[model samples]
Target: MVDILMATYNGEKYISEQLESIIGQDFKDWKLFIRDDGSKDNTIHIIDNYMKKFPDKIELIDNYNRNLGVKLNFGELMKRSKNQYCMFSDQDDVWLPNKISITLNKMKELEKVYDNKKPMLVHTDLKVVNQDLKLLNKSFFKYANIDPKRNTLNKLLVKNTVTGCTMMINSKLRKVISEIPKECVMHDHWIALVASICGGIGFIDIPTILYRQHGNNQVGANSNSLLKKLIKHAKDFRYRFYTEQAEILYRSYSNFLNSKDSRIVKEFIQLRRYNCIKKRYVIMKNNYFTNVMLNRIQMFLCC
Candidate 1:
């Protein structure tokens, strides 16, 4: 059975539709586990009503007295998962009818190739839509210029191509990421990094989710021009931010990492102390760059 984990906050507006879509999935052997991050809105009331209707299929985690933010909220839910496969769900995005069947089929294919004991992750593309469910972009990967095939540890460390709501993980990966660190930029990025270093990552080119974009989205797709994105990254880039996360990865899984991965992680953490020219050279020599050229240039200039 698959355990679908969802983290909710003040998402009363679109959550009902999202839950309805999940309930209408073609795949039937799954239970939805939801945890509220102290929503003051009618989100909890809606969830409680759903619970009364689908007691066996939907469950509300009882430890909602305090707020744990988004990352920790999903982290706690993942730790409580006891199924063979787990998929992260947003409180707002609508999953297509075949999402579970397709993702689970890919997961099974990956397990056959890599063996079930190996940590594995399967993620797909998404369709970007406006708050009114109108099509904003047909493909989120293309709309955002994200290359999902860049699943290497070095590339993922610089930028995350995997979207949490489009991802599914096997039991091995769920156990490997038993706890998410506070230094993690996002839960999905951290999980992708661990999978890249430890085992394999599978990608489906098809879009399985209607990725909703709204004013309240925590992190939505960016349809900005190349120049605009360059300026934004230049203004927001923090070398220390990336290094701190790498440091935590090294600290947490140094023993599990292979020699080359260990070296890459160490160099990533140490590059912060290097001179500007040397830092850029190290990034180039080690191939520690993202798939996007503008973002790579921004990293070269800012780091």
Candidate 2:
């Protein structure tokens, strides 16, 4: 059975439509597990109403109601998952009917090739939509210039292409993320890094969900122009956090990482100590560059 882990906070506006989409899925063998992070709005009340209607298929994990933020909230839900396959859900996005079936099928194929004990992740593209559910972009990956195929350990450390809402993980991958680090850029990025290092990651080119973008979105698609994106990246780049995240990865999974992987993580962490030119050189030498040219240039200049 698949366990759908959804973390909600102030999602009253679109939560019902999201729930309806999940309930109408063609794949029936799944249970929805929701945890609210102390929302001030009527989000919890709406969830309670849904719980009354589909008590068998949906559950509200009410034991913890404190606010742990999004990353920790999802981390707690991951810890409570007790199924073979697990998928992350956003309270605002509408999943396509075949999302579970397609993702699970790809996950099963990955399991057949790699042992069941090996960690694996399967993610798909998404359709970018406005708050009103109008299609803003046909493909999220194209909209963001993300190449989901570039999912190696070194590559993912620089840029994460996997979106949590569109991804499914095996129990092994779930175990790999036993504790979410405070240094993690995001839960999905951390999970992708673990899967890339520990086992494998697969991707489906098809859009699986309507990724809604709105004012309240914690993180949404960036449809800015090239110049605007470059200026924004230059202004907001936090080089220290990336180094800290690498250090955490090296410290946490040193035993599982091979010598090459260990060296890559070490080099990435050490980039902060080098001169700007040397930093750019090391990034280029190690091929730690994203697919987007502007972002890669920014990384070279900022790091």
Candidate 3:
């Protein structure tokens, strides 16, 4: 009933554990579409062995062994995805047995309300864990302060609370994200923005995966203290890239945005194109800043 798009890259150390986790899922109506991102290690071997064991449920994408970074690989996965719903998985994280069932349950419930026509996204919180799988935090949302109320089009311009590994996106969102412009940012961020603009986001407060935090993690969580996060968000250099990337998303999908969202994005884009006082005025007059005050000030400093 669901297609799991898993991207692997040199994950020999924990591939078996991760695959076992997936195989142990309480929800069995799922297929694993593995895409190896040029793993120099035995990652592919491990996945192949698993595919051999579960040929009916798991298989590798053909001629896709080239290294395309996680974002584009996932975008390609979306394009090739075949199912009513799709789920993303990391090569190393150990998912809870209930991960697929819980996410799919929420996805189905949300689609029912949206009549399955709108782009709906369902994501759960995660239990941050260490390399050895020791539990760190129970809820990633609480540790990261990921509030669903702030997941609007404007707020998504600054922050992304929707972690891909814990998300199950419907076919509508899968198709929408597959066609997102190349200039857009990461797949998860682009998906969140698309969900906000096209349909809606459904968040599960429960942790669905053991989000590992190994030293070699490509993109790990920021489990810093709240004060540290605020100070970090208040830095001009920090927001420059995010602001620029947000501009790319706006520039690419402006027409897809609603009138209000479109105007805000248009104004922000036009505002940033200017120099001196006009830029500052635009920043002040606009409501596109992040939900936090310090972050807004930091973005202002960026301007």
Candidate 4:
């Protein structure tokens, strides 16, 4: 059985469609816990209607408590999950009927290998769609040029591959997520790094949800332009931010990591503080860096 945590904020436009899709999931044993983050819209009203329609299937929380934002709202719900597995849900995306079934099956397969003692996380790619629910791409990984092979600790330190809506994590890791530090970024990114260090990290190449890009999203995918990334690299201070995340992860989760991973993390932290020459030397000596070409260049320059 699974507990689905949804963080809602002014999602009135697409809330019902997403709710309906969840209602159609082949796996019916799931319990949905929704926290509306201060929506000055009909989103809460719609959620209430759905709760009324499926009293046994849904539990609503943070009714009028606005301004919690996505991170804290989801964090509150994650802590209360009493299920073997927990999943993250966006109020907008439409899940295919088999989404829960397939994700749960893959989680089970990973559990078979990693066992229950280790934290387990399994996420799938998504079908990118426009506001009208028209397909923009068949495979998000290909369309975005994503390569999952680089989902390692050092790589994940800078980039997040585990999209929350498509992710299902075991209870053990859910507990860790509930305790994530305030300085941490998204729950998915923190949870992914935790799983990479302490347990099983699995991926499903096929998409399980329709990822909507409605242009009014609270947190949508980054702009898909090399030029924009270059611009953000300067304007957003992303290099420093990524370096901060790497430091926070090392400081917070060092105990969960093995000796080698801890060393890699420590080396990366040092590399961030290193000058370009020293950074390159450390990377050359320890190879404690990402594998992707773009990310490698970014890391090299940032370091």
Please give the ranking of all candidate structures by TM-score, highest first, separated by commas. Answer: 1, 2, 4, 3
Mark the regions of model 1 whose C-alpha exceeds 4 Å error after superposition. Answer: 216-226
List clash counts for every candidate, in order: 0, 0, 0, 1
lDDT of 2 at 5: 94
Q: Please, what are the lDDT tens digits per residue for candidate 4 over residues 1-303?
A: 899999888899999999999999999999999887778889888988999999999988755556866777777888769899989999889999999999999988878876667788999999889888899887777666566666788667656777889989999887765565556677778888888887768999889999888776423337888767655543532545666667888877777878888887787676557788887676666544443455556545563
TM-score of each: 0.96, 0.95, 0.89, 0.90
Supply candidate 4's per-residue lDDT for 249: 83
Model 3 score (lDDT): 0.78
What's the lDDT for residue 300 in model 1?
A: 61
Candidate 3 displacement at residue 17 in angstroms: 1.2
Total backbone collisions, model 1: 0
Best by TM-score: 1
**Which ten residues in a row are the worst by lDDT in model 3?**
234-243
* Residue lDDT tens for model 3, 1-303: 899999888899987998999999999999889888888988888888888889999988864548878887787677767788999999889999999999888888887887878889998888988899988778776665567567787677667778989888888877766664555567788888888887899998888899987876624336457666656656633444555767777766677877888876666556556775776676666655555675556655665
Range of the 10 consecutive residues with the lowest summed lDDT in candidate 4: 230-239
Best by lDDT, which number? 1
